[model samples]
Target: MDEVLIVVGPDVVADAGLIEEIAGREFAALGVRGSVTHARDAAHAAELLRDGAVVIPGRSGEMRELIGRAAGAVVWVDVERVDGVEPGEGATHLHGRGLGGIAWGIRHAAHRMRHPGRRRIPYGPHRDQWGDLYTPADSAPVVALIHGGYWRSIWAADLMEALCADLLARGLAVWNLEYRRPDLHGWEATTADVAAGLAALGDAGKVAVVGHSAGAQLAFQAAADGARVTLAVSLAGVLDLVEGDRRWLSSGAVAAALGRRVPRGAQASHGRSPHADDETVRLYIAASPLLRLPLGVRQLVVQGSADDLDLVDFGRRYTQAARQAGDEVTYLEMPGDHFDVITPATPIWQATAEAIAGALA
Candidate 1:
C-alpha cells in the first residue's frame, strides 16, 4: 500500500474536490492500495511527510519548503503562468497548466509507486539536467526521449511520460531526459546539456535517441555531433530554424530560442541582441538539423499529416535532405496531429515503436 499527501495552499486556483476525485481514480486504476490525505496547510503537510510517501503541493508561498520536507517523490503544481522556475530537487514541476496539471502530478506519483524499478538520476547540478531511467530485468537496448515545448521554460519532460512507459513495457531501457531551455538558461546551455546527458549513457547497447518538435532539433544536433547514437527519431520536429524564423513560426519561437528576444524584465545573460545579426545567423546554422545534414546515423523521421503545415513541410524537406546527404533515412508520414505521434495508444506511436524496434534490431 502507498500513501499520498495532497497539500493545499491558501491561494491555489485548482478545485479541491476535483483534485481529490482524480487522485482517487488514478490510485484505483493503478490497482494499488493507496490512502490519500488532503493536508490543509503547511503545518499539516509537514506532519504528514513520511518515508515513501508521494507528496503533491499546491501553489503557495511555503510550497518550496513543503517539497523539501517530503521524504519521497514530490510533484509540485502551480496554476499560474511561471517562467524560469525550476522543479524542486528530485521533484516533478507542473506550472501554468490548470487542474489537468494537478491530475498529471497525481498520476505520475501513482505510476512511480506502482513501478518501483524506475529511478530519477541527475547528470548535472542544475535541476533540469536530469532524467527518469527505467530498466527491465534483462539487458536491453536504450532509447532516450527528449520532449519539446518550443524551447520554453514553462514546459518540462512530462510530455514524454506515455512514451517512456510504453517503451519500458517492451523491454527497452528508457531515459526520459529533462534539460535547460534556451529561454532561461541560454541556447548553448540547452545544447550542451543534451550532449552531456547522452554522453553519461556510455556503454549502453545500441542507443536510439527520440525527440519531439523542438526536441527533434536537439536529437538531430546530438546525433550530428557524434553522440554514440545508432538511430535518431524525430517526431513532428522543427528541423529548419532559419526558415522557421522567417515564417515567424510559433510567433518567433525560433528567434526567442536563439536568444533574439528575451522576455521582459528578464536579463539577457547570453548577451544576444534583440534583432537578427551575423552571430544569430550562425547560431541558426549551428542548431538547425536541416543545415547539419549527413548525420551519419540511421534516421526515422515521423510526421503527422494533421499537424502544423509548416512541420509537415519541414519533415518532408529534411528527410529528403538527409537522404541526399547519404544518410540512411526512413520517412513515415501518417494521418495524425503533432501530439498523436507521442501518445502511446495512437496508431502513429505504434508505427513509431515498430520503426524503433526494427532499427535497434
Candidate 2:
C-alpha cells in the first residue's frame, strides 16, 4: 500500500482527524493512497523524517528539533493550505501563520473572559467606546493597552485585560482601551477611540502607549495626532500600511481597516483632536505611522522572531525610518511567535516591561 506519513507536533494532535482527512484527499489528488500518521515527539518525528515522511509546519520547539534532525531533506506538506480544506471552528484555515494568529486570538479572548478588569471607564456614548482601567496602590504613568485582531469586529480590547492587570500589579496604571472594530464603525472609529481615550486620561505623569498588532498602528497615530505621549511601545505593530496591503498581510486586513486599497505615498487627513469628546469618523491612508515620522517621542518597536515574516520585516522598516527621521527609537527582537509579544507571563513580556521602564525613565 502506498502511504505518506504525516508528522506534526503536540498541538496538532487534537485536530488529527481533520488533518488526516485533508491529507488523504491531497495525497489522493496526487495519485497516491496516503495514510496519515502523527509522531508523538521530536524523536519520533526524526525517525519519520529520516524515512522520507512529510513534516507539517509548526513553531513548536519539538518541531524545530525534528526539522534539524531531518538533515536538510525535510518535506513540508501543509494540508491546511490545501483548497477545500476548511479549518474547524475557532481555527484559521489556509496558512499555518494564520492558524497561529487565530489560536492566540482565541486564547486571549478566553483569558479576558476569565479575568475582568478593576474598573471600566466610558470615553464615548457608544457601547464599545469604553476603557478598563487597572490601578496600582500608588498612581503611576498611564499605559494604554490596545489589543489587535486584524482590526476585525470580532475582537475587543478585553483581550488585553490580563496584561492590564499584570501591568497594574507591577505599579503602572493601565487603561485597557477598546474601540469599535473597523467592520462596525470603520477605521476612523478605531482611531477616534484611541484619541478619546488619550484625551480622557488627561496629561497625568508619564503617558506611555503600548499597543499590539493593529493597536500599535492606532497608538502611533494617536501620538502623532497629539496624544501628549512621553513614550510609545509598538508590540508586533503594523507600521507600514502600504506595504501590508501589498503583501496582503492577515488576508487583506489593511484593506478592510481602510475601507479600500490605498497606494503607497498617498496623502490623507483624518481624525480629530485626541482631546475631543465628539463622535466623528475620519480615516486617512497617509496617516500611517510609518509615514508620520520624527514623532518627537521616545519609541520602542518590539518584534518577535517567530512572528509572521511580514510583521518582522515591517518592524525593521519602521525602525529604519524612525532612526533616519531622527526619532529616539529602540528596535528589540525577541524569540517567540506573533502572539508571544502579548502574553504577559513569557520572557518576551519581561523584555517589554523593561523597555517601558526605560522609555519612561
Best by TM-score: 1
Candidate 2, 36: how far from true, in Å? Answer: 31
RMSD (CA, Å), candidate 2 to true, equals 14.0
TM-score, per-candidate, Cα-based: 0.84, 0.65
After TM-score superposition, the amount by which residue 69's alpha carbon in candidate 1 deviates from its true location, in angstroms, is 1.6
In candidate 1, which residue ranges exceed 4 Å CA deviation?
A: 1-7, 15-39, 48-59, 62-64, 82-90, 261-277
lDDT of 1 by residue, 1-361 (tens): 5665556665555567886787677666656555656677778777766543445565566755665542556676666665555454456667776666665666566666666777888999987898889998889999999999999877778888878888988889999999999888899999999999998898998999999999999999999888999999999999987677777899999988997632333221123424334565556657889877888999999999999999999999999888988999999999999989998878989999988987887
Q: Which ten residues in a row have the lowest lDDT in candidate 2?
A: 85-94
Q: What is the C-alpha lDDT of each candidate?
A: 0.79, 0.68
Off by over 4 Å in 2: 1-117, 264-285
For all predictions, the C-alpha RMSD in Å is 5.4, 14.0
What are the per-residue Cα lDDT tens digits for candidate 2 across 60-146? 665654433424323443334332222222222223233333333223333333344467788899767888777777768888888
